[model samples]
Each structure stands twice: as structure tokens, then as C-alpha cells.
Target: METAPVPAFSELISGTQRSAVHLEMRDVYDPGSRRFASWRSGHRENPANRDEWWNPFHSVIAEAVARGVQVRRARVVSEPVSDYVQFEYDVTFSNIAAGEQVRWLPRRRASDLALPGNDFWVFDGRLVRLSHFGGNGEFVQDEMTENPAVVKLCVEAFERVWERAVDHHDYRPA
Candidate 1:
């Protein structure tokens, strides 16, 4: 059976590229239940939406590790404020199937990228990639997507921050 086509953005360069994409987003509080609920209700604010957005990406990483897809991640463990705790991950794909892992990420301003802020969005098209603004309006979102070169630079930045980051066990399952 045929599947639906992936959406593209002006900032995002759509093509079959053997490249690494860097992504940053606000982590949903109750991703498991909330994520799935949002998907069912069409309510981005709902808890299930968080899970819907993350599980697939998590799976992608897991799969890459399993199948040897050449992927890795770097993240910022903490920020000055709770809301500022920015976590970034870089997934490099050695295998580009179906044009660069069809994906999407919602954008937020650098200042507004904080805790209880909820201004981040990310998704691998094959997985879940949507999020809601968790009621904080401190940050105004300026979003865009580019090609491999720009993405590589972002990945480098994520690596720098990741080096100083603390391991986050908050979201890890028991």
C-alpha cells in the first residue's frame, strides 16, 4: 500500500540527502499518556501529543543503533532557569532512505526557549513530530529549516553544549 507524502517547509530543504539533522524542542511533561491522547483528540496541548511526538524519534534512534544507521545525539542538560533547560540531539544518517528521513520541528525564540515555556517542536516524518506551547508566552517563535550544511553547524553547537550537559534521567523509563 502507498503512504502519504511528507510535508516540506521553506526553511527546510527537501531532498534525498545523506546528512545529519540537528533538532531542539521542549520536552513534554507527560509524554506517554499525553502524547497519544493529543493524537486522538487533535489537541496538541493534551498529554498524549507529547508521547506521539517522542516515541517515534526514540524508536528511530533505537533502530539506528540496532541496524547501524550511523546516528548520534548531543544535548544541553540544564539552563539558568528550569524553562531554559534546552536539550538538543543530532541524528546522522549514513543511509538516506526516502529522502532524508522525512521530518519536522516547530520553532521557538532563543529567549523563550525555557522550561514551562514549551516552545520547541521536532519529529522524524516516519515518527511523531509535534508539540504545544505549555502556556508560557515569554518566547516568541522564529522558525526555519535549511539544508545539510546549516544543519551540520547546528549539530556542532549541540555537541559543544552536550559536552557540558548532565545526563537527564527525568524522562527515562524505569
Candidate 2:
């Protein structure tokens, strides 16, 4: 993992050959974004309309999936979900359409498991791209690492959460 010139999310995922697993532990990330505002204002993106729902993020994921790279995302949220989490739930069809498997785990169910301090994506079980967020749920820069100890910790943590989480389609935020 190279941190000097931090690579984009697409670069990280493209470099992966086998699998990419992401563990998102935040209930509200970037809470003041326009996307969330639009959703709150009763503006929903129609999945059928690619022009309306497609974006760079989805494009990269779809490309990776076409190349046989398995992508999975697991989120840990509070029991009574935050507004942002509900918003995320409503927009997850795009992720599904892009070929990413998503799951959600309640914080209560994760009490016994050891988790990382920040969110991250472990690529091919070797490199880890850690997500950093401000105290106010604002977007922060990401850091990448290839330390064996750190990678192992993230991989294990992600697997633990993924195992306990419910599939996105079945998860009913509450």
C-alpha cells in the first residue's frame, strides 16, 4: 500500500485480483452532503435510468465485477438507525446493480467482536485502505497500509462483521 500519493478508490480496487472487502462502521458519514439532502426532499434516483443513477463509483465497481473481482461491503449501525443510514439504505440499489454484495449489522450484535477504530477496505486480503472521518461526520482523507499485522486485523474484523450482518435486501433499518 502506497500512502505518499494516495490512490483513488478505483485504483485500489483495480489493483486487487481476487477480492475486496469493505467494513463501514459509521452510522452517519458526510451528513451534510447534497445527495442526502436530495433524498430527504423526496428525490429518488430511478435505477432504471442509468443516466440518473450511474456514477464513477458504480462504474468502477461494475468494471471490477466484470473482471471477476468479488466485492463485499459490511456496515455496522446503531439499533435505531440514523438518518444517514436510512438514506444509505434507500440508495443501495445502485451498489447492488454495480455487483457489490452489501450487508448490515447492528451495533448491539457487534459488542463481542473486536473491530478497528476506523472504517476500511481490505483488498485481496493484503492491502488495507483505511477511511478517516471527522468527529462531525465530515469526509476525511484515507490512508493505505500493507503492514502484515494491520492487514490481518482488518481482514479478521471484516469477516467477523460480514458473518453476522444481514444481506442488504433483507436488512430493514430500525
**What's the TM-score of every candidate structure?**
0.33, 0.96
Instruction: Tell me the tens digit of each residue's lDDT in model 2 across 1-174.
Output: 446456988898888889999999988888788889999899988878888878899999999999999999999999799888999998999999999999999999999999999999999998888989999899788898988989999999999999999999899999
Candidate 2 deviant stretches above 4 angstroms: 1-4
Q: Which stretch of 10 consecutive residues in model 2 shows the poorest summed lDDT? A: 1-10
What C-alpha lDDT values do all the predictions have?
A: 0.32, 0.91
Where does candidate 1 have its weakest 10-residue lDDT segment? 86-95
TM-score of 1: 0.33
Q: Using lDDT as the measure, which candidate wins? A: 2
The list of candidate 1 runs beyond 4 A from truth reads: 1-57, 77-149, 168-174
Query: Model 1, range 19-87, lDDT digits (tens) per residue?
Result: 233344443333334434444454433323434344444544444445433333333232232322221
